[model samples]
Target chain A: MQFTSERRLDGAVREREFALGEIPGILWTPGSVSAPAPLILLGPPPLGLRKTYPRLVARARHSAAAGFATATIELPGRGDRPRWPAAEQALAELRRAMEAGEPVSDEIVDALILPLVDRAVPEWQAALDALLSLREIGGPVGYSGGVISIGTRLAVVEPRISAAVLFAGSFVPRAMFQEARQVTIPLHVLLQWDDEGNDRQAALDLFDAFGSKEKTLHANMGGHTGVPQFAGDAAAQFFTRHLK
Target chain B: MQFTSERRLDGAVREREFALGEIPGILWTPGSVSAPAPLILLGPPPLGLRKTYPRLVARARHSAAAGFATATIELPGRGDRPRWPAAEQALAELRRAMEAGEPVSDEIVDALILPLVDRAVPEWQAALDALLSLREIGGPVGYSGGVISIGTRLAVVEPRISAAVLFAGSFVPRAMFQEARQVTIPLHVLLQWDDEGNDRQAALDLFDAFGSKEKTLHANMGGHTGVPQFAGDAAAQFFTRHLK
Candidate 1:
């Protein structure tokens, strides 16, 4: 990881803006940690992380103040990372199938999600490795933000991540639900009850498929962005219970 | 409706093939109706009422045996009707937006549903007008088959349709849920739980938003065409309870 800038925030938080190879990101930690602190990793939004994502920054600060280090790395096609040309082509084909009133095949669904996940998950794993390597950060990792499949994959593959806060406002490939049935980590899932763009029954199905003995689905009514502010507080509590 | 051909089918059903203006279709009535019988209008499948859709024919025959005259008009772009040339172009634009990972705004959703609904709903209304005018068919109209919003729109505007059996295995505009709230007819909705191309949650949300005093959702597991044989029996029962 290459640190390009360093700063102090809210008087007692240390903020560093850096890049893990090509993945750009920000990390925030409590200014002074006598011992290593627990860590949280925030994933990219559908639009990817931008200055407009005050939510990520605030969550980072929330984690930092709660005595944990927090970090987020840009996913490809997001922030400074240029998009893969294939995503556009794949999406175009999927939408065309939809418009022609054709049933989107499993291959098309795979094209829509797998490539983006494959591109982003490795960067996330690498970023997690780099973030936890820092002297002030310790074990017990939490992952928040979604594309729920990403969290499911990470929970299954990354032993370091102890808990996850999954946003269910995105589509899950049918095969991924089978993968989700293997996710046994403590999980806190958020669902916008009235998300127009999301497949609601699929979200419920994914949640139902989760193998986690300790998993909770927090659902609130509204559109895609209708998650209430208090929902974040509940997520924080969930992370504190599991990660802390 | 102008009758162009007549035949006796499966022993006791009278099959009258007809056209409402430029639209051509088939109607089946139980051979001996002492009085005017209730009518059920089957909406065209996405592929249209072709030989592959033996399901439509079976359902019509089922409704006919249940004592309701059954009819299905050719939706535009199906059978005798030519497809709108702009459907391909609109689909291309939609595909472009999706490829770019753009949020489908209300305008885009409207673009996807309104035109299809606009083209199909009027023809359905016209067909309903013509079908009910026949001496063998009258009163309490039932509409079955869908992308579903077609049924919602018809239920809201077409008073002749006193009940509807909506197939929820299709996309719904976010605004249509509100329109669904205006649907006061008795409804029996069917959903294929594992529909690949559908937003399952949208189907549930639409079902939740229906204002009908008697609305039943029959959700079965499997792919888009996976509605079980029993579902047809239940729907036949629903139409009997309401239309008869």
Candidate 2:
């Protein structure tokens, strides 16, 4: 891993950009954390890191102010990362279905999401290895919202991620539900009640599938991108309760 | 309002039992608030005050610690109040249906909840008038859990009640769903996902019917009596946000 750029965000947070092989990622840490701070891995949004920077930096600053280090990696098919023909075809199919006002089929969902999950989970684990090897970042780590399926898969396969805060999005493949039932770590799942592109029942069903003894579903009144500020604050509180 | 008895609870909360005409009620206030404390009217559980005292007082103590006065009144045909034959019959019918593994009919649900909502809303308003008249208790007020139908009606009719934390119980009358759409106050609704007697879909539907633009549904894994401790704390946090 090699850091290509570094900058101080205000005086409270330090931001650094890095590359793990070909995968680009960013790390944020408190400028003044005394002891080793507990680490939280931010899940990259499907829109890519550059476009999602403002929101991600806001989250990073919030977590930094709370005495935690946060990081995120570009998904394999997002941003400047290389995208394969299969992934591009899946996206085109999804757009065509939406343009024709048709339901997104399970095959399209699997093709689009499953491969990303299959690739991203290992890359996240690798990033964890590199981030934790740093002198200041410490475990027990947590994963926060990106793709719901990726979060579910990480919660199931990744042993180091002790807790997660997931945003429920539509088009999750059926196979993810089976993986969801195996997730035992504490979870805080946020759902937008009126998200136009999302199925509310499907989100609730996925929440019910989690085998965690301490899972909470917080559904707020909004469409996608309309999540209330207080909801975000509550998610931070959940991470503080578990990771701290 | 006539004070029936007064006691100091642990030197931090002062508890007073009162009678408004024939209806029995209780009031709790923080011992050290300099200005008038904002009030929260605790909704009386279906199982009368005497039986629910332990839980009610726990909530009272919690709100008191947060610098709020909390109060509750006995429901009509419940607790020390007299029960009419119709109400008694409704209870009997509900129990028989449950024991026989049959669905409780809409008629039974209306008979059981509608009368309570009708009699209780006025009594709660009267209680609010009396409680707020006290020098120690002030508004804006929030109504918290008991029978959800009653909370819905109160949210619709009672102007003083600014926000509510409603427990999404089973058997909410269909009429209340209509009233729920009229409720404009912010709501924080709690649903026990696996409650044996509660209909999860019905709860979800009622949550859907609520017209409040600022509503939240916090669903936790549990049966009727298995609501996790953190869920209760979160409800209190909701009240604090709106009331303060």
Candidate 3:
């Protein structure tokens, strides 16, 4: 990991931009810690880091208030990173289905999400490796945010993430159901009950398929992006329960 | 309302046993309070108060520690309260169906839950009237516990109950679905996801049916009585968020 830039978010939080190979990421740490703070990986919605920065920074600042470090890296084809034609083609197909008001087929979901999961999980793991190596960031790690397929794959494969808070999103590949059954870490899943474009039953089924012995599904009354503030507090409490 | 007994649970809480006519109930209040404390009515199952005292007292004490006065009343056919023959016959039918390993029909459910809700809702309202009249108790009221059908009815009818934490249980009458739609208070619902002998789909449907603009369903991986301590803590947090 090479530090590219740095700035203080506030007196309590410091933000550092870094580059790990070709992946660009940001890390936030508490200004001072008596010991190495617990780390939370703030997974974004494949929306690119610049667009997702405000929400990520809010979560990072909140975690810093409780003495934790948080980090996020750009997905393979997201943000300023290079994009591939196949990924672009899948996105076009997904848009066409939505424009025609047709149900998003399993094939389309798999085509769009499977490759993203395949490419993104490795980058996340690489970022995790570098984040943990930093002197200020070490302890039980947590992953919070979505494209939940990537979170599911990470929970199944990443030994360092002791807990996760997954936002239930649409376009989950059916094959990810099999991967979900391998996830054993404690999980806190947030579902927007009335998200217009999301598949509610599919989200519920994925929650049901999780292999974790301790999993919680918090379904709230809202459209997508309408998650309430209290819900965020509950998710933070979940992280505190497992990571601390 | 007549106080039958009064005592201190600890340095922080005071416990008082009371009678509203023939109905028996207990109230817990913070040991020291400047303003009138907020109230939470801790609803228990139809198991009778003697059987459910320990759990009720624990919740009461916990609420009191948060500077909230808490209370619970025995249902008509429960605790030391007089038992009706109709209620007795309903319980007999319910056990017989369960012993035969037959699915609990809606008829059986209505027979069991409807009468309790009918008898219980008014009593809870009356208790609210008396509890709120007390000098030590005031502010926003919350109801936390089950027979979920009772909670549903109370939430719809008792407007002073500005918030509630409803424990999802089996044997809900179909009629409550309509009443659930009328409940507009902020709600925090807890469901034991793998609860033995409980219908998970029905629970999910009830959660979906609730009309509250701010409602949450927290489904945990556990049996009926296996609600973890963290779940309890979350419910408390919910009450604190609204009640305070």
Best by TM-score: 2
Residue A184 local lDDT, model 1: 88
Worst 10 residues of 1 chain B by lDDT: B213-222
Residues B131-160, candidate 3, lDDT per residue (tens digit)? 888887887999998688999888988889
Pairs of colliding residues, candidate 3:
B48-B79
- Model 2 ranges off by over 4 Å: none
Global fold similarity of model 2 (TM-score): 0.99
lDDT of 3 at A88: 91
Error of 1 at B21 (Å): 1.1
lDDT of 1 by residue, B1-244 (tens): 6889998877788887787788888888987889999988888676776654587767767777889888887777666477676765666676787788775456666776778888889888888777777777778888888668788899999887888989887667887888999999878777776677677777778878998756656555567987766557767877877777
Candidate with the larger lDDT of 2 and 3: 2
Q: Compute the DockQ of candidate 3.
A: 0.94
Tell how far residue A118 is off in model 2, in angstroms. Answer: 0.6
**Per-residue lDDT of candidate 2, residues B1-244 (tens digit):** 9999999999779999999999999999999988899998899778889999999999899889889899999999988688899999999999999999998899999999888788888988988889989998888899999999989999999899999999986588888889889999999999998889999999999999999999999999888867787788888888889988
Candidate 3 TM-score to native: 0.98
Q: What is the TM-score of each candidate against the true structure?
A: 0.50, 0.99, 0.98
Among all candidates shown, the one with the greatest DockQ: 3
Q: Cα RMSD (Å) per model?
A: 18.7, 0.9, 1.2
lDDT of 3 at A23: 88
List, residue by residue over A123-176, the lDDT tens digit for candidate 1. Answer: 888888888888888988999976888888999988888999999877678889
